[model samples]
Target: MKEEDIRELELRAILEASNDNIVIADGKGKVLRVSPNCYSIYGMKTEELVGKTADELEKMDVWSPSVTKRVLQDKKEVQVMQHTLTGRSVMATALPVFDEQGEMIRVISFSHDLTELRQIKEDYEELRAKMEYYQSEIQELRDKDQHMDGIVLKSKELSNVWQLIHRVAPSDATVVFLGESGVGKNVFARAIHDKSNRSKEAFIEVNCGAIPETLFESEMFGYEKGAFTGANKEGKPGLIELANKGTLFLDEVGELPLNLQAKLLKVIQEKKVTRIGGTQTKQIDFRIIASTNRDLQEMVREGKFREDLFYRLNVVPITILPLRERKDDLLQLCEFFLDMFNEKYKTDKVLHAATINEMLDYSWPGNVRELENLMERLVITTENRVIYPSALPFHTKESQSEVFELETEELPEQADNLQEALRDVEIRWLKRAYRQYKTTYEMADYLGISQSSVVRKLQKYGINS
Candidate 1:
């Protein structure tokens, strides 16, 4: 073949093999040539469009608003999205060809099929909406879970105590909480009231020790109008009267004087109260819950507390153990208090692992209240994101060793032989070590015993930890 003819044939082959749909039209908008791929993009054979005009193709319903016709009219390049009757979406660009005299000769158009891309974009949008909906649902469920799981108590004894509180909360029984100061007695009292049938009513709390001896009767039962000197003229209800149909929590009930104990007992037994200097006795309906760190039985024996009142108030007794004994719940309480102070102070502070270990090793004599205060102080005083042991307010050499010393108790003297005495000592040490450490491996490491020996001793001694 001639070199010029070979060049022309190569150019024609290049046009036919293009990935995009190629069409060549005359300046008058008559289609003169089309690539074979036009069948895939426009659902039409190339021969059908070879000799057709834009006006004729419009009648055949191949494409609307012809790109070639637009380029011919404007005598410039034009790009547009196209819709064909065959339901294919396409992007088409048309350019006008000009001769040396600046006269329009032909128009060429390139088109890309966009139907699959549009479908994929639609699918992605739908999936994004579904993910957003599921995320909202998960957040809602997590909030509900936190609410339902009220107080954090992990020790077996404390867990049992919580279960007992729930069981007795539905009734109108008088409950007495005996524990050390700051051992969360009031918290348990509120929990009981919240879970009871009278939850909708007010839960009134009174510190019996804070009230004066002379005003104890008037403070507990409402005084009538002008009943006493300096009393409210309109007559105000007292703690007992204010707690009608609800729960009255008398904290430090052991502080009530011997003379007033008889009167308080009469009011509780009869469910009626007579205010100071008042003639009429009014009926009161309420549940009474009392808490005291003192031993009421010892007080009764010592003639400081009334035996009758003690029996009346002790319908169900729940004693909360000190914080040092329930070591399993230390981390949980720390997280709760950290979250509380973080929200209050608007700071995101976290405790370091060493700081947590130090807290676990210290004897918490002030119990949950002390931990809460310490967490708040750390958040306010510590400027860094992580809290270290040196920053703790109670960090000291004595405090670090206090927990272990308190865990050990005096040896029982009843053992007859040296071997039996050694066995008793071993049991006591094992029990204390188990309470301080979480796992058998930890206890073994702390006590200088093998892990297998720790397990065997725990099983032999009937220890459930």
Candidate 2:
């Protein structure tokens, strides 16, 4: 063959061997030829595409808004992203081939498949979002520095509780906390775990009342793959297993079902747990810290709670008084929560003197949690530099009336000497307040006196808790 024909043959072989789709068309946008790779790349046979115009391909629904037609109309190179009917993404580079007269003679195009790259990019973005979500949740769980700082301790009652915590936290003994709901039983559990030798390990907290009865066993003991319908295919570890070498805080333990209570007592005694629907038993080493607002002894008497489980769990009991019972901590707690809400909502609102007195005088049935929520509300809704009693959702007038009724009850019969008569009346009133309230701090708050004064009078009156 002649040298020009050989060169043409070599060029045709190179284009056919290329991985990208190569197409040659006349200046009128009629397809003259396409490389064999067009079938693999664009899902269209090269022979079928040959002699087909851009308008013909559009009518056949093979390609939308043909790049070759764009280059033909403008007589210039055009690069565009195209999606074929077969759901393949391609980058189409169409160039006009001009002769010496500066007029377009033919068009050549290359299509680079970008489907895999797009899929990879989408997968990366999805993974990044999942990582961020998990990271935030992990930070919320493990950030003890934030949690420890939030607890308020400003009274001798709480100071004594802290001393007890220090005494028992060094040991791996099971501790049971008794308190009203939202009184920070979980906080005390966390403090014990943080002070223990297993502080480096996970402190898994589970609410016995929160888990469903049907899922309680699976959640506590885990399950093997195909253990039951809808079970995880890869199997899962339970909260007990997760708490190995750490602390397992079971809040609202009094709410545990009788059957599960037996199972839990067994796990505590045996130090081993068997997964649901599996024969294998795993040995575990974890500390137990249980809390409940309910009286487990009363439940045991009524046969609602297992007596064996109660004795096993109640090795050492710590009673956390309600906020009304520790009124001295109220203002400090209010200030702490105010600071937290100020930082959270970016506000500088201060409490008015009347608002502080209203907070002090009112009986907080919801305890510290209520106060925290109130501070957040004031921070977000207060329109002035200071938060006033008018901003309170509850009526301070009604609360003041309740306080007055509690204090203004009729005094006992009088004595002979005027001073002696006053002292006798005061003692009777103090004794009545003590009987009415659950704690000395609460009596002091109701009588508008200090907790220390209440203690001193109780001591003088020979009163016992």
Candidate 3:
């Protein structure tokens, strides 16, 4: 072969063996040439893309947002990483080709398959999303940064309770909220429902204490039109029916009568409920959250409540401590409720330090509910820019037990007159030693209580702590 023939053969070999996708197109962006590398990237042969316009690969699902914009805008070379019109990832280089006189005559595009790199990128993105979800859920369980609407809180005791609720709410267990009326058992129930699998369904709450016995059956298990003398004409679906796939909170469950206990038991045991004076039985699926201040277990022993139903309903127990026991959470809760009621009442009456101290000192027998009511009353009734201790409904007094233990100071001598105060000091030091000192010896030195005394108190308190 001649020398030019040899050079032409070499050029063809160079183009065919090239690793990058090289394409030569007309000035109008019609493809006229394609190199071999185009195959690996686009899942197509060189000849396939040669005759098609760059815009014609719509069916392949490739998104080819061309560097055409950049090149056209700047009238210069452009480099871009984009998915092809057929959904293939490519790193592309585009430039305008000019004629001998410097007038634009053609356009050339070169691309390389970056599908593997793109796959790696997508995998990272999916992983990042999963981590974000896990982190959010973890935060919720800790109640550290708890959420209400868009709010986040870090109340210590409240966070502990929030985390416990998240852990317990998902089970098929029965939860009995122990709090004063209006302490927000209903809110807790709603939170449980929100975290549960049945979140997509209804949430029904029935106040057993509020409704009379005559209407109990109609309100809970449904009723035939004539089942009661004055029932709805077409008949009404009870709360049980309305709460088909979600949760039903029996507030004041202590008020449910003895006769109705048997009925409610049947519904819980068989997952079915019967309508009053109606023969049909319906299968029921739901979780139960019951709340009351009454001692159901004690009531059962006293013959006021059924033993079997009490056992069944106590599947998963969460006893809410009264606000007095969780004094660590009082200030935090006060601040939160203040901000909340401020928004509701559209007022910014700040609580005075003395009033806050007074609020903290009182033993809230009614728990959070009572505190909320007191705050609402103060907010509504007070006209001053600041809340005063005088605004409190009653004088702040220490609980009887606390009042009995008050002393001028600790004594160095053991006297019968100081026995009760000294005993209180001994108990306090025992707790402080075990928890804070992490050793009995150090606690004994601090409180002048013996290691043996600490040991005995720990046993009396039934503490392994």
Top candidate (TM-score): 1
Model 2, backbone clash pairs (residues 3+ apart or across chains), number = 0
* Model 2 RMSD, rounded to 1 decimal: 25.2
**lDDT tens string, model 1, 54-164?**
768867768766898889888899998888878888899999999999989899999888989988988999999999999989977754433343366667888788889
Model 1 whole-model lDDT (C-alpha atoms): 0.85
lDDT of 3 at 53: 63
- Expressed as tens digits, the lDDT of each residue in 234-339 for candidate 2 is 9999999999999999999999999999899999999999998899999999999999999999999999999999999989999999998888789778888888
> Model 1 segments beyond 4 Å from truth?
1-150, 397-465
The weakest ten consecutive residues by lDDT in model 1 span 399-408
Candidate 2: regions farther than 4 A off: 1-147, 396-465
The predictions' CA RMSDs to the true structure, in order, are 17.5, 25.2, 18.7
lDDT per residue as tens, model 3, 77-181:
989887765567788889988788877666777777888887999999999999999998996685544546322234455566778888987876788887666
Error of 2 at 312 (Å): 0.7
Q: What residue pairs clash in candidate 1, if any at all?
A: none
Q: How many clashes show up per model? A: 0, 0, 3
Question: Candidate 3 — which pairs collide?
Answer: 62-85, 62-86, 62-87
